[model samples]
Each structure stands twice: as C-alpha cells, then as structure tokens.
Target: MSLEENATNRHGSPAHIQLPEQLSSKFIDRFIRLKTTYWNREYAIVLLAIIGVSITSQQFNTYIKYIDFMNQPNKTENFHLYGCLSYNLFGYMIGLIPGGVLATFYPAHNILGICVAISSIGHVIVIMSISYLNSLTLCILQMCIGTTMAVGDLSIDRVWTYWVPLNKQSIRHVPMVMYLVIFEEGYLRDTMDKLHNEHSSYSLTLFIGVIGLAWYVLWLYVINGNYSFGSLNRDFILFGGLNNSRYSFEAYGNSLTRSIVSDIPWKSIWTSKPFLAIVVLYVCDSRLYQSYYYNTDLFSNDVFEWTMRDNTVVLLLLVVVLVELFPEIALPISTTNVRKIWSCSYFGSLGIIFFLEVILGNTIKNNKMCQYLFKEMRHLYNFGFYVNTLDIAPKYASLLSSFLMCIHYYISDILWASVVRPILSFA
Candidate 1:
C-alpha cells in the first residue's frame, strides 16, 4: 500500500503553479515593464485606435441620419428611414460571411483603413443618387456601404485581437465604447450632414476623398499587419487574388509556415452548449439593436419619430450634467441566468413596445405617446447591451460576440436582400 501510495504521489499535480497570493508585486511589475518598453508589437495599434474609433463613431452617427436626410423630400414620413436602416443592416449582414473570410486573409490594418475610406464613397453615392436622380448610383452606394461596414467592423476585431494582449481585450472595449458614446452624441454625423447640405454631392464626395487621403497617410505611417513583427505567427495573411490567403497561425516555431484554414473553430464553436447560449444572447442583441428605435416601420414614413431627436438631446444632457442621475450599473454575471434575464427583459420590452403601439399609439399623429415613450426606452436598451457585455470577459468578448453578429447579419442579409427589399418595393 505504501509503495502504491508513493507511485500515485509521484504522479501528483505539479508544484510550479503558484498560489493566488503569489500574483503580487512581481506579476504586476512585469506587465508594466512589458507595456512601458513599447514591448507590444504592431505600430498600427495606435493609429487603429484613433482611426478605427473615428470611422466607427462617425460612420454609425451619420449612417442612419441619411435615411432621414434621404426623406428630405417629405419631412413627415420618416418611415423610409427604417427601410434604409434595414437596407444597410441587410447589406451588412449579407456581406459579413465574405467579410470574415476576407479578414482571415487580408492585411488587417490596410483592409481596415481602406474600408473606412471607401465607406465615405458610399455616403457620397447616396447624395449623388438622390441629387442627380440616379437609382444606379444609390444602389452602388448602398452596396458599397454594406461592404465597407462589414470590412471595417471585421478589421476592428481582427486587428484588435492581433495587437491587444489576450489580457487587455476588456479594457480595450471600454475605449471602443467611449468612441461609440461620442458617435451617439452626433459629433461626426452632424458634421457630415452639415457638409452635405453646404456642398453638391460631387463636392461632398471630394470632401470625403480628402478624408480618405488623410486616412491612407495615417494608415501607412502607423499601422502594421502584425504585432511586434517577429515572424508573422498570426493566423492568416493576404495573397495575390481577391479570395486567396497564405496561412493562419504558425505551428511550432518552425520557419516553414503551414495552412490552418481548415483548423478554424467553426464546428466546435457551433456545437458547444455555451457557444449556443451565447449565440442566442447575441441574436438578442440584433433584436435590441432594432428595438432601440423610436419607430416600428417594418418601411416608408413610419420611423425615427420627432421624439427620438428630443430624447437624444435629453439623454446627452442627463448623462453629462448629473453624471450619476442614472447609475452606470455594471452587472457581473455571465451565467445562463443573467443571459436569460437580459434576453427576457429586452424581449419583454419589445413585446410591450409593440403592444403599446397597437393600443395607444398606432398612427404617427395618434401614437405620439408611443413614439415618445420609445425614445426614452431606447436609452434603456443601452443598459441591456451593458448587461450582456458585462457578464463576459472582454478578451475576445468583442470577437466571439461579433462572430455571432457575423452569423446573424448574414442570415438577416439573405432574408432582407431577397424578400424584404423586393417586397417593400412592390408594396
């Protein structure tokens, strides 16, 4: 028995693993040293931080506003705006499949920078199509906008994962959220709108061209494809053609790199129970995104009521002035229970919102209260998003969640592109 005990003990757990208390001053000191010494690779990180945030902030802010602007022909009917949003979202969702594949191959920084620049073309195209009376241009612009948005969104996650140490993804998302906050406040979008009004579509296009020029300069100067470029141990690389790639993730430290395209975690991800729950959670995010609206126009003049504008003004004020009027509640729960609550809350709210719309506020003039209530409610939606993000670790949280977005968007796109848009046209 003693001999058996000794043999079993010999195979016992290794002792090299440190206790929790051992993660003390020395552990922190090394991380600090790592950051301070410019030890992090990828010069593009700094530029990506600035430009990616800028593009996303402005793109989001102004992208939807165009639906309103497009409906400038009639001030009263903004339901067409929702149609436009659906158009954008549809395009975005459809394009993400190829977008993810492209990100796997492309030089991430360059692709991101180019995507940002080209997205402006999409905006300009909308203006030209409207002004010059050309549906062709509008279609082109819409398609491009969808494509660029997919590419840029993909690049942000891709590049972030590359440069940010696996440890810092959560902290990184906070700044990303800050940029989102900026867009929510309408800094860049409003600026673009003002520019659009002041200039012809061509002139606006030129203005965007200048912004693109600046972006390219910044991209080339600061952005790089890999972090601390030793050997590109990264998962993938761009090749000669539109849809070719070198390889993903190096095996061993061997100089001879190998293709890992097949090794993508798709099946495992889809099969895992936790992954499925997260997928359901993220699918709810898409719904929350849609429901965070002052309109239920499923097209035409039934979207983004006047109350949305008013509530936006109020939201900025309350958030800025009181600081603590609304508690920035951070829920620390990633378990199934939390996901269930959040999903139900959002879904329940959506149900109630629709119910109220039918009973109290169905028509534009009749449903002023419904419109107004939703304006307030939309801000509440942010908390739902917060709850969802809060429960998870930030590391690849943006990514893994975004992957779900990729899937949702893809399916939504197919439905929208094939069924929704054509039906709307007929209707």
Candidate 2:
C-alpha cells in the first residue's frame, strides 16, 4: 500500500504526511528546474569543467613567467626563451587539424576527458624536466603540452556546440569571461613570500593536476553530451533519483542538420560567403587579441619604463581585465543585436589601435586609457562570432574553428617575423 493509504488507515487522515511530501517535491523541482522543460542542469556542469581546464592548463605559462628563467640559477639566454616560445606555438598549430578531426569522429566529452588527463600527467613530467633545466627535454614537453592544449580547446568548443542551447549562448559565456576578473594573474607574485620555493610550485602543479583528473571523472560520468557510448541518446540519472532522458545533441542541433558523418557539405562550407567572412573576422580578431595579450607587458615596459610593480602599471592591468566584463553585462537578448554590437566594437577597436599608434602614443596616461578602451571594444566577440561558428555550422564548428585558427596563426607568425619584429627593433 502507498504511504498515504497506510497512514490514513492507521490514523484518521494523512494530512501531515502529505504536506511534508508536497513541500519536499516542490523543493526538489525548484532545485533541478524540473518544471522548466527546456533548460538542462548539465550546462552548468560543462561550464565549470571548462573553467577548471582553462585554469589548470595555465600552469606552464605561470611557471615560465614567475621563474624569471633568464636571471635564474639555471640561467638561459633570450634566444633559448624565444625558441621555446616558437616551438610551443608550432606545436599548437600542428595539433589543431588532427585535434579537430578526432573530436569530430568521437564523442567530445570523451576526448576532452582523455586530453585533460593527459595534460595533467604532462604537468608532472614538465615539472620534472624543469628541475634538470634540460633544454631539449623542456622543449619536447612544451610541445606536448601545446598539442594537448589545442585538443583540449577544440573539445571544449565541440562540447559547447553540442550542449548549450542557442538563445542562452551569450549569457552562459559570461561566467567564463568574468572568471578572469576575479582570478588575478599577479596573485602569484603577490604571494611569492608564502609559496617561495620551487618544490612548492611543483606541489601546486600536482594538486591542480589532481583537480583536473577529478574534472575528467566528472565528464566521464555526469555529462550526457553529443554521443553517449556509441549511441545518440540521452540516458543519465541525476541526484534525487530523477532520470533525465529528454535531451540529446541531435535534438538540439540545427533543424536541417543530418547524420554527422554523411551530411557534411565540406565544399559548400569552404566556399560559402558567410564562412569566408567568418574566417576573415576570426583571423583579425585573433591577431588583435594575441598582439595585446602577448606584447602588452613588453609595450608598457619598453615605452613607459614602468615595472609591473608600479602603481600605474598595476592599475592599468586591473582596468584592462575589468573591461572584459562589459560585454557580458551589456549583451542583448537576441543574436542579431549581439552581431551588430560585435561589428561595431571590432571596427572601433581597429580605429583605436590606429589612433593610439599615430596620435596618442606619447603619454603614459593616454596609453593606459587606450588599452582599456581597446579591451572593452574587443569583447563583443565573446557574445557574437565566438559562438557564431556553432550557429552557422553546428556539425562542423570544431573543424572549421580549427582551420581558421591554423590560418590565423600562420599569418600571425609571418607578421611577427617580418613586420612586427623589424618595426619594434627600429623603434
């Protein structure tokens, strides 16, 4: 007999039992959004996993920057540093195509899990290599790390394509971008008195690796993504004994989308105007972003002779990072509006870059203002073209994004070698 029936048979009625039961069910339904049929709770999990991977993957960069390798006990020449950087970039470029192809053929979450685990183990090996200061070993490990970085990047893109709903894309990306504001990159330097030893750094890397492995486990079991165990069906159990079987990538994909393998219109996609436009936009977008991120520190030091510890320099960096959050707050509800904002902001940034170089490049205060404006202008991209790859070609977004990245990096490397290097040397 049902609990209500038994209670009623024993007592006069089951009013007390039913009230608590109803309240518990209401609480659970509110917690899981069971009343809302459209929004899946797994989306939040995917975002968290992506954030975890992004933060953990930066260990190499963190170590390289904080170590001040050129002045260290194992002192190396600048040429070696340059070579390491070049090799790392090359590794990422070489892996892009293969990584995209692999993600396309397999389930994205599965590939993501494997890549994160590999990257985690790689962290240990990389730390060991650093102790020896063996250039060859370090270079090879950096290359491997770069390759995993590419694959991990593509996997996350594919997962986002498969998991996040269309209309919710802009708002969902906000958290990841906002994460940068709170995660102060200079915290390592600020806390150097505490984590002062190489061994401490090594231990931290290992701890992060463990966290990354936990992320892998979460993806392996919790997330029901594009393809689950060779089938295109969603079958997963959530907490509170609720079985969630209502969502799948196929159901969420574009209406005209067909079987993944047989339906890819590669020739059309390659030659189409929209795709070509997207490539042009992405190349320019990536170039601007890379230029700022990689060289902004150098620019400040060379032009203004300001160290990172300077009050002005620290404030500038804080302002630049804070500006990244503007788009997330200002983003509109519709994709069309988002696209308009992106176009305006992108062109406006290019104009600011030109104006800064030609007109206002003299004063330190002007430079700081210009840097803040430039960063603020670029982020409409987070809402627009960043997500539009999936919008245009849901099935082929990963492959296409990879191809665009390859092209952009090739162009960037060439420009850096021939144009940027010579100009900076002359200046």
Candidate 3:
C-alpha cells in the first residue's frame, strides 16, 4: 500500500528507522537547554536597557512630581507650550523607517551604539536644563530630547525584531516596566505623600540620572555590542581600506542604502493591509502614552484632588502592563483566541474609566472623597492594559493594539486639547 512497503516487497527487507530512547531524550534535553540559553542572553541585554532607563524614567517622574507639588502656572503651561515642538510627534512618525532600512542592509552593533550615543546626548541636555531651569531653554531641550529618544528607540526595536524569538517577545515588556516601577515612582503614593515638601528631590534625581547614564556607556562595551564583530567602520577607519580615506566607510553604507532603497517600491505599502494595521496600532498606542504623560499634571492638581505620584506611579504602570501580559504570553494557544481576549480587556479598561468618571461626578461632592474613588478606579483600569498586552502576540499584538488605539487616541487628544483642556478642566 505504501511506498516503503512496495519497495520492501520488490527488493529486500525494509530499512530500520529506529531512534533510541536515551538518544532522543538527550537530544531533546540539549535542544531545550540551548533554547533557554539563547533566551537568557537576549533577555539579559534587554534587562540592561531597563537598568539604563531607570535613571531617566525616575528623572521624568521627578519632573512630574515637582510640577504637581509646586502647583506652578509655568509647570501647567509647559505641556501645552511643548506641543509647539512638533519635533517630538514627528520623531514618532518617521522613527521606525531608518531601523527598517538598516535591518534590510546590515546587521551589526555600530547602528545600536550610534542610536544610544545620540539618545544619551538628549538625556544629558535634559539634566543640564533642569539645573539651569529657564522655561525657554527647557522647551528647546525637550524638543532635542524627543528627537534623540525616537532615534534610539526605533533602532533598539529593529534589533529586537531581528534577534528575539517571536513567541517570547511579549515577555520582553516585563522588563520594559522595570523603569516605570523602580525608577519612575509609580507605586509611591505613600512615600511621596510624606516627601512632597522636599523640593530637592527633583534636582537630586536629575544629578543622579546623569551620573548613572555615564555607566551605561561602559555596560554597552561590556556586552560587546559593537554592531559587527569587526565593526563596519573599523575596516575603513583604522585598517585603511578601499582608498585609505577617512570617508571610505561612507561609500559602503551609501551603496548598500542605494541598493536597498532602489528595491523598495513605495506604492506597495499602501496596498498591504497588515502594514496599514501596524502603523495604525503604533500611532494609537503611542498617542495614549503621550496623552497619559501630558495629563499627570492636570490629574495631580490638588484642586482636582489627584496626586500624580499616588495615582499614576511608575510601578502601577509597570504592574498593570506586566502582570496581565505574562500569563497570556506564556500560554498562547491560538492567535484568534488571543485577539478575542485582547478586545475584551481593551474595551473593559475603557469602560471602567468611563464608569469611574460618571460615578465620581455623581457621588463624590467633596474633593477628598473624589480622590479616593478615582485612585481605586485608576488601579483597576491600569490592570486592563496589562491583560490586553500579554494576550496578544507582540509582533502582531502590539501593532494591532497600537492601530486600534491610534484611531481613538487621535480623536481623544484633539478633542481633549481643543475642546476639553479649555472648557472641561476643573483647574
């Protein structure tokens, strides 16, 4: 009936396809060990990113806290005024393009280092601006900071996509929360409540952040993260190749770029549904994050009776994002199921916030009472996004969420900025 049986009947006896139990187990065991090792190494590198960002995230939190505690008009105006720096938003729009280009043409550490070094310059400037405290200077510095942050971020994402296993990528977000939790002061409503009077916390945090980043440069070197083993630049820069010129390396990158750029047809992108969805997702998710960042002050206003440190602490952000994502990622069975669960949670989070707002408006007359009500509600909703992230696959899951979020995020931001900020704000 089968080819093997026919061959055996026509010729001699069938060939034995025997695998020993010990050999099979040993082989499987070795494979499992190798996979674990590969995962650990990549994870360790990402953990270092968490460590490096901890200082910066904390500094950003300190800024949010300072604005809240001081309750300054200048501090409130900073968010709206900073919006004039369209450079920050523009950075997000085009951020992923260069990374895509580099991944297509080259795979190495030089690109990574270049991205980090440029971003570090942004951090350095922010720290410097804080020490100086001129409003105009701060706004300009914020614009520069946004540019470098986008550049560095897009570059890091490119590397993650290329090297990390698609299945395990969702777990990557757990460490992503570390900066929010440990460094950003997400869960410190109690501690921060007691320390609100101390103005030095903001200045001291920035000073420490600058010193901390100085060590990230060393961490990069320790990891041997130089893009290429023999960096693309070294061959032309130090070893002297293709003409013994300083700009020789430029030719290599340029030629590679030209070849890649020429191959890509611009028209095909619009026709691709998956690509469109991804862009939508990134736009939406980033918008929510930006809105959230902009609102800490309004929410923290004692007039509104919400404390940013207590309400939106970095740990809360980290926990809400991570706790839910971990189990879903670990037990993924089907994409369809993941999508269903994701939609449920996404909508659920939105619903909870809406319900909380309505309840706060109706039941709580006293500002103090409203604060307690909203604070509990905030914690509950934060858990929703965490569940949403973990249930979906990162490559597609994050992109999908970003796309859907983008639609509502834009509508909300425009409405909030144009209509709500002026008319509806309590303060």
Candidate 4:
C-alpha cells in the first residue's frame, strides 16, 4: 500500500528492510534544528515574561516615593519610612526559602505568573487605600508585596534554568540587566508618575495585574503537554511537543530523573568552599551598594553641600552613563572567570574613587565624576556573583540565590546598624 508496507512480503515480515544512512542522519539533523528553533522562541518568551513582571513589581517603588508622610511628627515619619523599609527586606528574606521550595515542587511558570498576579493585585489594593495608610498598615502591605516579589523572582529564575541550555545560560542574565537599565534610565518613573498624577495609580496597577494574568495564560499555552511536569511519560527531549512513548531510551529516563533531584545535598552545599566564597563576595558587594543607595541624599547634603536639584541632576547623569555603557561594556563579557576578574578590578577601583571624591569634596566636578564611577562599578557584581549561584547549581539555583540574598540582607542590617552608621556619624 505504501513504500514501507510494500517493502514487506506477503507475511508482512519476510523482507530485509534497508534505509540510506545518509537520509536517516539528515532527517535526525533536521529534527534537531527544528527543536532548537522551537526552544529559542520559548526562551525569548521567557525573557519577555520576566521583563513584564519585573517592571510591574518595581513600578510601585516610584509610587511609594510620592506617598505623603509630612503630616506626621518627625519620629512618626521616620518610623513610617525606615521601619517600613526594614519590613520590606524582612519579608523578602522570609519569602525566599519558601519560594524556592515551591518552585522545586511545582511548575515554575505557573508559580511565576500566579505570584506576579497576586503581587500586582496587592499593589492595587494598597494604592486604592493609600489615603488610609498608616505606619503599621504600610509596613504590613510592604511585607506582603516583598514576599510576592521574592516568589515571582524565584520562579522566573528557576524556569530559565530549566528552559535554557548550559552553553546559552549567560543570556538568562540579560532580562535582569535590561530591567536595571530601564529603571535606572527613569523611563518607568517619568511615564508612570505622569499617568498616576493625571489618571489614577489604582487603574495603572490594575492594568499590570491583567498583564500578569495574561502571562500565565501564555505560559499555559507554551509549556503544556510534553513540556511540563505532567508529561513525565513523554520522550525526554530538550524541545517539547512529542507524544510518542514507544522507545524506552535509558538516556532519556536518566535525564528525566536528573532534572528533579529528590534528595538535595544540603550539607555538601553549605560546606562547599566555592559557595562560601560566593556568599562572602555577594555580601560585601551588597553592603557597599545598599549603604551607598540609602545614604545618597544624606551624603549629598552633609558632605557635598549639594541641593536637591543638584543631587537629582547627578543621579540623572549617572543613569545616562549606565544606559550608554552597560550594553557595550557589560553584556559582551561571557560568564567565565573573566566575570570575577572584571568584578574584582572594578570593585578595587571604588576605593580610589571614593578617596578622591572625599579629598576633593569642595570641587563639584570631581565629586560628580567620582560618584558616577563609584556607583557604576556596583553593576559588575550582577554579572559576576549574582549569576555564579545559578551557574554552580542549576537544579537548586533559585534556592541558593534566595538563601544567599537572605543572608546578605540580614548581615547588611546588622553591620549597618552596629558598625557603618556609627563610623559615618563620627566622620
């Protein structure tokens, strides 16, 4: 009836069937290329989803800046601001472990979408009730927002690890870099603030929530059937959409098992030298960056004798530099030992810049230039230590990232309160 059937005898099994080896190989190669193309599209969508959620979650930061706390007493105002800020970090720290654990047990795309949707909804509620917000209420809302953001962040990070191959793993960092670049450029702040002032913050926030739901719907379409956890019986291939299960390939079985490690080696991970080194590097880098960010206005006022407009101008200039240089300078650097090399070199230069800025504090030009260079160096940490956690342990990448970040937050709080603040006050 057909070529394959015609090759058989009257018994349907008496003939020796042969196929051209070249033809078979060509067919396999073509399938592989098609699969690669499919996965590349999936990866692009993953990055797009990441960009969407990150922007929505972070948009609230600008709105929070506009909140009126001037009516309260000085002590009350300070508590509302600083206390709520601490609650945000605390909530994020608490969420990280649970978020990572949930991602390990469930579908990452679902988790990301749901978490972001909930976060956006939460922000909408908070913004709707902005007039009723007090210190306690604001703190509670911030903690809730922080927890959801942590979960969303973990889910996206975990999903990419599952979706992307080792050779192309570095591209996973691009979404985050782009997020930073966009926010630093003040595009979101300028546009969203204008919308909020003209229309309403609640409407804007609700729109973001709708987008989050759309992300979930898109994920369901993209990763259903053979790609998700429910398709364990399907062929274990990098690309999805296969339904046949006749072949019992041991390699496929092994790979499927490897993807979900039932037993995580916690003891080995904690005691590992590389893990400890990465933790230390990240902690130190975060401490410097956080301290600098929180103290910028104070430092500008006290040390530089700069007005608010001058400080804002300095920030805008710094953003311009980041926008122009980040892609050209940071994106091309492969995730290799060179990441560490560049990070260390840039970090070391900060001390020199800081010294010069402080020594020549009276000169506005020197102060502005030094401040820009010093702040720009902090971005190198993302290219280096931030991605190192994922590179070292892809299966537990979210878990490890959350753990390290939690530790950094805790340590930063302690060191800032006990050591750094006192030194700055004395100086």
Candidate 5:
C-alpha cells in the first residue's frame, strides 16, 4: 500500500484529500531510513546533551578530589565538602520550575544552548575560584553550575518527543543510552585520575567549556536550519515526511504555547494514583541513592578502607554490565512490569546492602565480593528506573520529569545536608 493510504487508514483522513503524487517520495525514503539509523540528527542532540551531562557528572563525582586540589596548602574539613555539595543540590532545586517553564514555551534547543553556555561559564569560575582560594566564590559557582545542569536535564524529554518519531525502534533505547552515558562519566573520572593530575584543573575546565560552547553553536544551527516548532516544516525532509495526522503536530506545537500551570491537567495529574506512586518511589529512591552517591568515597573508606580508585573501578564495571545485560533481560517484559520489577529490586538490593554493611561492619571489611555484588545490583536497579521514566506518562513526559526531578532533588538535598552531613561531622 502507498504511504498516504497507510497513514489515512491508520490516522483517518481529514475531509480534504491530497494526491499520492503530491507526497514527497524522497521525504518518505529519508524517514524510513532514519527509522533504522542509530545515530540520526535526533541522536546527535542526545549525544551532545550526554556530553554536557557527563561533564557535570564528572565534576560531581570527583568533587572530593576537587576539594583536595583546592586545599593545596591548608586542609579543609568534611563540613566544607558537604557544604559545597549541598549548594549544588540547592541550585538543582532552584532551576526546576524555571527550566520546566522555559522548556514548555521556548524550543528545547534554546534552553539547552543557554544552560550549556552558563555551565561552561561556571566551570571557568570554579577553576578561577580554586586558584584564588575563594571558598565563598567556589560554593556560589557550584550552585550555579548545578542549576544549569538541572535545566539541561529537565528539558531533554522535550527534545526526545519532538525530534524522534514514535515509530522508530531506536527510540526505545534512548533511556538506556542515557544511563550508560551517566555511568561512563563516573568511570572516566576514576580511571583518568592520573591524566587529571598530570594536567592543571584549568585545562580540564577549558576542555569542558570548549565542548559546551561548540555544542551551543551546533544546536542553534540545527534547530534554526533544520526544524520548526509544532509543524512538519522544511526539516521533515530529514525524518522522511510526517506520515502521522496533522493533529499530532498541531497538538505538539500548541503544547509549547500554553501556559505551564494553566494548560496542564494539574488536578488530574496530582490525583493520579500511578503518578503519585511513581513520585513517592522516586523520592525514597533518590534519598537513599544521593546519600550513597555523595558520600561514596567516605562510605568506602570507612567501611572497607577502599580508595576512590577502587570504588570508581567497581562502579564502572557495574555500569558496563548493566548497559550490556539488562535490556536483554528486561525489554522483553511489559514496560510497566519492567519498571516495577527494576525499581523494587533495586530498592530491595540497596536495603540489603546497607543492612549488611551496618550489621557486619567489622567482619566484612574490604570484602570485594560484597562490594562487587552491591555494585551490580545498584546498576541493575538504575537501568530499570530510568527506562521506566521514559515509558511512563509520555504525553506529559517533560512536565512529569521536571516535577519528579524537582521533588527528588529537594528531598535528597535535604537528607544530605540535614541528616548525612551532620552525622559525618560528628564522626
């Protein structure tokens, strides 16, 4: 059957009909080809964003090392480290609502470009602050950097929805790809310690800054030259033609224009049992996860006397295993089932790991077997939770993501600052 006929039958025709000959065969061919292409224009955006996220992740994961670098002559206390980290989380909270609003109205690429540029500036500030031994300046810059990362992260869902057609099989893999990117950054930070020591912090900051600036320029070019808001304009040629109903495009475009709070079904969303459940799950998960993540080095040192390198190597291996293995195990199941299973399993495993660490504190010291097992379980759980987010509430994907992330960061930050840091200070 002709593409037009297939679309008409699938979406139902409008009152008016156009001839098949009027359809662009070339466009259709391009779209068909893009369906299979693993690294198309949409994927290019994903990749650039991944790089941006990885840079931020690397900074965060290596904050302890950064702190050591900053305290070249005088040794700072643990409170200083926790305080700097808390500021980043505070910035994450500050960014969410504004990021969501910006993403809803402006093009996602615009938000991304601005956020990336700001983050690059923050990196520069961080390097300078460290050199000058400006503690307050460093804290403020860290917060600003965190906010920029949050904005970029919150806006990413919009890019996926608009740029990648729903029909493509490759779309399903985007979440997994993102997970791998995040974990890879941690791995790189750990493994590249020698390289980082060889070079100055200025070199690292400059490298990340150059990448962000380059991505911003590329984003502007692609969004303006190739794509249009709310319609299949000139750039539809890249995706092959839009075969779906015009209403889909219209709705997407209209969504951007509507007021963020007024346009959304806030009452329905808040009342939604599934949505509420997911929010609760995320809050609990984030609290535990962030606490563990922020204090990973301390936890390893205190519990097992493992160095940062050891912790990072284990984390990297876990990420690799998850990236390679989980999809084969979980993708065959229903998306909802996969989400539930993964989340529950992850939480359970974390709980078990924590229990063991606490209960067998002295006996299991430097126990590589226990550490490896815990790492694998943690990665598996992460794989599941991320993929689940992509599948759940796709229509309200961006808004839902922003809401969940905002709450998650807020709760996690609170726990880290109020509960975790105080205890660490005393210890």
Candidate 6:
C-alpha cells in the first residue's frame, strides 16, 4: 500500500496532512511543562529581578562609601552623607506613585527598561559630577538614581504578580536577595577599603552604569521571549511595536466602567482596621530600618572599633546564613504561622542583643558575637516586613504597597534629616 493510503487507513488522516491547532497546542503544552523537574519562566524572571536588585544595591553601597571616602581628607562632620541619603528617600517619595501608575498602564518590562536607562544615566552624571563635587549637584544626581531604583523595585512586584504562580510556593525572595547583596557588597567594600583606593568610587560608578545597561538588554530579551505581552505570543520583539490590547488595565479588571464609577467603596478601605494597622506597622518598621542602616557602620566603627573586614565576616556568618536558610525551614510549616514565629524569634533575639550591647558598652571585646546579633536582627526585620506586606490586602496589593512606601520614605527622610544627622555629627 502507498504510504498515504496506509496512514489514512491506520490513523484516519494522510501522513502529510497538517492540523496546525493540534500541533501548536501540543508544542505549547510541552514547552510549558518541559522542565517540570528543574526550571521555568517564572523562576527565570525572579532570578533576573534578584540580580538586578543586587547590582543596584552594590552601586548604592559604592555611593555611600564614596561619600565617606571623599570626606576623609577634610574630616568634616559628614553632614553631606545625610543630605545624599535623604535625597534618595525624597526621590523614592516622589517616584513610587508614578511608578505604580505606569505599571498599571504599560507593560512592566517597558517600565523596567526605562528605569534601568534612567539609572544608567544617573550613574554617568554622578561620575561626571565628581569633578565639581558640589553638594547640590550630587544630591540631585543621587535623587535621580533613587527615583529609578524605586520605580524598578516597585515594577518587579507587579511583574511577579503576573508571572509567579498563585500558590504557597510563591514566597517573597526580597529578604534573601537583600542579605546576599549586602553581604557580597560588604566584602567588596572591605577589600576596597583595605586597598585605600581613592579612585575606586569612580571605577565603581562606571561599573554600575555598564551593569545597568546590560541588565536592561537582558531584561528585554527574557521578557519578550517568555511573556505573552498583548497577544504577540512567545516571539521576542522590541518595546515600541508591542500590541497593547491585552496588557491594558481594563483587561486586568482594574479599570472602572462608567456605571461603576461611583461604586468604588473608598470609605470601607479608609475605615478598615487591618488596613490602618498595616500602614502603621509599615511606618514604624521603615523608621527603625532607616535608623539602623544609617547608623550601623558608624556605630560599629566608633564604638566597637571594628574594621570593615570584621563587620563583613560577622554578617556573612550571621545574616547571610539566616536569611537564605530560614525560608527553607519555614516553608514546610503552615503558611499562616511562619511569619509569626519567624518574626517573634527575630525581634526577641534582637532586643536581648541590643540591651547587652548598651550595658556592656566598649568593655565587651566579643565583636564577633555583637556583630552577628546585629546582622541577624536586621535580616529578620526585613524578612518580617516583606512578609507582612504580602499578607495584607493582596487584591489591592500594588496600591497599598505604593502608598506605604511613599509614607515610609517621607517619614524616614524627615527623621534622617532632623535627628539622625545631628546625632551622627555629635558622635
């Protein structure tokens, strides 16, 4: 028998005949499930977000260290340091709302690309401004960098909403990423400090710009290839040519129809106890966090006389291990209780450590123990805050988050400007 005839007789279709829908469906299903044992697009996007945040954080550390290094010669009060840091908070205050709004209307990937571009431009400007070193100019550049970083940070949450599966498995990785970034960059800062390279700051800024550009390029490739942006399917393409039909707010049920314009029920949100509680919690946490971060290095150096290498080693042994490993231990337990247990343990331990440090003062020679306790506390606090943000109001999560961040940054900025600066100068 001829092949066609034999095929038709056996399978009810000729061998050469094509069923495009069937073939495409099969291919898509296989592609989605191909790496069931290992990886997927969701994991890829999360990893990219982690890496981008890491690079940006490293750059931030470089900026902080650069300011300190610049001030070493004059032995000034380091007031400019607070000014630079406050400018970052100010930028975050202004940028977060717009970032959240933009993410709602545009593809998150596009917004992310713009953020990275702005960050790169900010880094270049910082490098150029090094010649002048004017406080105003540096503050402005730092603010721009802060704006881009805040926008990119907020945008990542939205991207996760779309890409991450809605399951217990979708725990936030922000705490772990933060710990890793801080640990690695702390080591780098220590090494550079040891070298005593006055020019390292310039080199670090240039390096950050290059990394930002590369991240943007890689993001474009990965997002285009993996995400279904407005029915273009899996084909990778540039941003401008994207079809916006499917990615709109209306498609996502976030837009208000004319009939429902007056039915948004804003009063309930205002009066809701949980909502109010979350807002309060966020503010207090942010304030504490800002104070801790701004003072830790200064306090360690001045009080304990700990070198950068000692601090780095202590953090690596404590925070890095706890933040990276705790999730694994907690994941097997009930989701609702994980945050509670983890948080209580963290704060309780931290409180004890702080009391001991204050009472013992400089007489305590165990720098390693003190450093370990402080690092662990910082990590746990961050992890707890992150978990709380996710747990409250997931449906309006983006709005709640942006609002909380705006408040947090504004308050933190004021506190830093008014209280932290004077204290540091006096110390």
Candidates 1 and 6 compared by TM-score, better number = 6
Q: Model 6: per-residue lDDT, tens digit, 113-212?
A: 6777677767767866776777787888788888878777776665555556334332344433354445543555565455446557667667777887
Candidate 2: pairs in clash? none
Q: Which ten contiguous residues of candidate 5 have the minimum total lDDT?
A: 238-247
Where is the poorest 10-residue window by lDDT in model 3? Answer: 238-247
Flag regions of model 1 displaced more than 4 Å: 1-94, 105-107, 117-146, 165-172, 178-187, 224-261, 281-344, 358-427
lDDT of candidate model 4 versus the reference: 0.61
The TM-scores, one per candidate, come to: 0.53, 0.64, 0.51, 0.64, 0.64, 0.63
lDDT of 1: 0.51
Residues 1-427, candidate 2: write the lDDT tens digits. 5767766686445677678888888666654552242245556655755665575556556446434533467665643466567777778888898787656655666666677778777776666566576777677777887788888777666666666645434445554444432333343333442453554655665566666766665554555454344432332321101122222234445332343444566789889887888777776666666655664453443333223224333443454344333444444346567665777677777667766665756432456666545544554355566666767776566788788788777875676679977998999
lDDT of the candidates, in the order given: 0.51, 0.59, 0.46, 0.61, 0.61, 0.60
User: Which residue pairs overlap in candidate 5's backbone?
Assistant: 27-240, 31-239, 31-240
Q: Output the lDDT of residue 150, model 5.
A: 82
lDDT tens string, model 4, 1-427?
4667766646554224434565578667765654564347666656765664665565456436445323244533556557656787778778887888666555565567667666767766766676687778878888887787888778666676766644534434645555555556454665676676676555665565566556555554465544456554332222222322321123345443443453567788899887898877776777766645664543443234224334544554454445333334545665576566757867777556546547765332435665555544554445666667767877677778777767776776687789988998999
Worst 10 residues of 4 by lDDT: 239-248
The CA lDDT at 24 in model 5 is 60
Model 1: weakest 10-residue lDDT segment is: 235-244
User: Candidate 3 lDDT, tens digit per residue, 1-427?
Assistant: 5667757685544444323655678667765654574457566665554444344333444445554544465445554244424644554444444444543334323344444444455555665565466666565555555544444443344334434544533334444433344433344443443565654755654554565556455545435545443543443332111222222234455575565555444445445564555444444444554544454333444534335444445555455344343434436455345443554554455445446647674233334554454444433333334334333333223233333444443655675578757876665
Regions of candidate 2 where Cα sits further than 4 Å from its true position: 1-40, 62-71, 74-84, 128-134, 167-169, 179-199, 224-263, 288-334, 363-369, 415-427
Clashes of 5: 3
